[model samples]
Target: MHIKQATPALKAVAALLLTAALSSCGQSQNAGMPAAGPASVGVITLQPQDTVITRELPARISAFTVAEIRPQVGGIIQKRLFTEGSNVKAGQVLYQINPDTYQAAYQTAQASLAKAEATLTSADLKAKRYSQLVEIKAISSQDNDDARAALLQARADVATAKAAVETARINLAYTRITAPVSGRIGKSSVTAGALVTANQTTALATVQQLSTAYVDMTQSSTDLLRLRRDFAKGALQNQSGKAKVKLILEDGSEYAQPGELEFSDITVDSGTGMVTLRATFANPTGELLPGMFVRARLEQGVRHNALLVPQPAVSRNQKGEAVVMVVDRDNKVHARTIKTSQTIGDKWLVDGGLQGGERIVVEGLMKVQDGATVKPEPLKSNASAAK
Candidate 1:
């Protein structure tokens, strides 16, 4: 009975020893292998670059020059010379007023001048004859003086008549109306036989130069100040040292040609607190018309050391702050809030909270959280390939 019990104990001890050895072997095997870690994620490293700052503003297309056609002299329109809505050259005749009355007045003034000249001639002969008579005692000294005074009066009358003739001539020439400027003329306000007054309040027609166009835009005073501040701090540099502008048509198409920024209003509008800015563009095809609504993309300046973060990497937190998942030096992920100023293409212009060379998690964001170690894979950019 003792031997049987002893054999059972020995078997139990052997079984225990076998189980312990197997456990130790399994632990050693696992120890030799690597432990599982956090998952991998796609990331992009931040880089500082030079970027241009541009803004689009509401604008209006206008003519480079506008002239209102008005009559300088009052007259009845005899005939319309130029076709309505046609291009006109400077000093081109556009209307013909009836010159009948003016012609008659001119002739009358000429007759008056002739009559005054005849009288002057008679006075001259009488004055000479009277002076000769006085010298020989043929007439009194008083008679010679009277004759000289008549001659002076006659000369004055001739001068006055000559001036009247010139006035009449000018009035006759004014009967024909001409274009004051070279441009596309609008429709005529009055047809032939219609009477018009001199310098009337209503214009007879309008002309606009369409070869070059002006784009008028309004910007807030605050924005203007900010740009000035940037310039003062040297944060922005002008590549061409010129504020270049571009036009966007009403149909959402960009203008083929670029433009130059010309003028800015010194005074801000009190009603809207907006400053008016003007830009000029070449419109050889007459595509830009007066009063047409458009938009202007103004290149403010170029900024250096600009940090751009891809838009896919940005997310808004519960507090409505823009945040991103940043990977640290030790491969640990951290949630960081970033300040973004504007958007450049498909990226956010990172203004604060991140530096160049820092990596941001772009993919597998949902797979990892703060303090989790990750395998970061560099993101391949399509734009780089295109470049």
Candidate 2:
């Protein structure tokens, strides 16, 4: 090799080049290596839980008892004993019809009864005399028989007079129209001086018992059948001995008192294909009125082992099917199509497509795609968030 003398400036330049080459090689190695681990996702572990499912159905408030006040005896209304739109008790006089005619009729019946009694007394004395005469042979047999028949006829007349008196008394009582039930009374259809007929088609007034009211709720026959089937299959349990119901007023405020499901009609409404269900609620304040629209929250049954998934974790795909992202044992994400029937609080009541013990992505869903590898991090439960 030839020995060449190099300058100090050239030697410094060579060192700089070598340093640059090493830096470039290190940068290339870093670029070829993996950037980071799989994306971390917040997930919830699926677990079977007991859930109480309730349905909200439209309902109408009805009075426990309804009475239409009608006149039993025809007469001119003399006075209205009760104030319109006020509470009245059973047997409280609501209207007073003219009793003058009834009183006269009653007096006439009494006079007739007195006359019959006088005749009966005379007939009894004559019959006794006839019996004695027939035994002593003092009177003819034909005369005694005639006397006995007259006595018997007199007794029948007395009985008939007594019945007439009773009828008159009943008619006099009917002059006053009283409430049949204790309840709030509506406006009077007939005022003072209005003539009313016996058993008139038009009512004088109406009274509705409101201390306790009924809520008539209609449910689809299909849904009712499904509930029955579920209960029969033991899929649902009646945790409460009786079904409990809550009322939502028309203004959207919940009624303070809860009610119990009374009974469901056996026959379905042919026109609507619905079953009529009734619930009884206390209306001490008279807040609930008849014909008022409301909603009833009815708890039909409880499911012991139900799979619930957070609502946020569920999404609808292009096909409008409900889907959830679940992590497999290999840490791979999969989009699962699920069947959801209803919402239990903030969770979707999953009917199918998920088994217990699967890790479902609840948060950080935007960062991961289906079939993507992910590192699942256990997320805090939000069970109470719905409430």
Candidate 3:
């Protein structure tokens, strides 16, 4: 019985020793193996290229020409000859006031003019006869002088009568109100038989030329100064022959036709501190209406060598400073602060804080920390990825 117990204890000790030796071997094997390598990140190499810069500004649509139709003379409106919201030609009759009174006045002035002319004829004949009589000593020199003065008075009276007739004719024409400009007419404020006054404050109708439209945009004085400085420094070039502009409607639809920058105000607005810019666009389809809100995309200038980085590669810190992760030659991650001027598509135009040939991390930013080792991978082009 003693031998049997001793054999069982020996077997247990041998099994425990084997388990310890295996555990030690496994620990040595793990220790000898190297740790995992650094994490891999996608990066893009920065390059300088010529780029065109455009600025989008809020703008307001205005008519090329606006005219308010008002009565030149007071009278009862006899008829409204135009349909509301219709295109009208210049000098097109729009309204017909009661012309009965004007016509009668014109006729009366005409009769007065005829009577004055008849009197002048008689005066001229009498003056000539008196001159002949004076020469023959049949009439006194005083009589001839009196006849000549009468003729001059008759001529003056005829001139006054002619002016009255012309005035009456002009008044009669005013009764037929006509469009002063060729454009689209708005709603009429008066109807037939409606009483109107001369030079009334209220307009009978409005006409706006819509064939071509004006887009009035504003830019801050500071920005204008900056742009001028850049131009003076030769940092930007206007490759486009003229200042070209494009429009975006209130509904976010782009206008089919482009526009030209007509002019910019020389003086800044005191109230807003902005300079007004006007662009003219063709509106053959009449899509752009007066007072419509729009946005104008104007090509400001071209930068010869501009550095741009993908927007996704840049991140803002607690202080709201733009920062990016750059992989150095040693494959070490670095946090670099950058100043971005504007966004162009999916990229940001870098104004400072970066140089050419630097590797900017675009992917796997969360996996790596600053100053840590990273495995750099070239970012695939979007076109290649799409394929």
Q: How many clashes in each candidate? A: 0, 0, 0
Which has the better TM-score: candidate 1, or candidate 3? 3
Candidate 2: list runs displaced more than 4 Å.
1-40, 382-387
Worst 10 residues of 3 by lDDT: 378-387
lDDT of each: 0.90, 0.92, 0.92
Q: Each candidate's TM vs. the true structure?
A: 0.81, 0.88, 0.88
> Candidate 1 regions off by >4 Å?
1-40, 120-156, 239-241, 363-368, 382-387
Tens-place lDDT digits, model 3, residues 1-387? 899879989999999999999999999999999999999999888877888888899999999999999999999998899999999999999999899999999999999999999999999999999999999999999999999999999999999999999999999999999999999999988888799999999999999999999999999999999999989999888775778999988888899999999999999999999999999999999999999999999989999778888888899999999999989999999999999988876789889999988888889999998999999989777322111
- Which residue pairs of candidate 2 clash? none
For candidate 3, the TM-score is 0.88
Please give the TM-score that candidate 1 achieves against the real structure: 0.81
By lDDT, the candidates rank as: 3, 2, 1
TM-score of 2: 0.88
Which candidate's TM-score is highest?
Answer: 3
Tens-digit lDDT track of model 1 for 1-387: 889879988999999999999999999999999978778998888777888888889999999999998887888898899988899999999888888988999999999999999999999999999989999999999999999999999999999999999999998988888888899999989998899988899998998999999999999999999999988999899767568999989999999989999989999999999999999999998999999999899989988988888887899999999999999989999999999988766788877999988888988999999889999988787234111
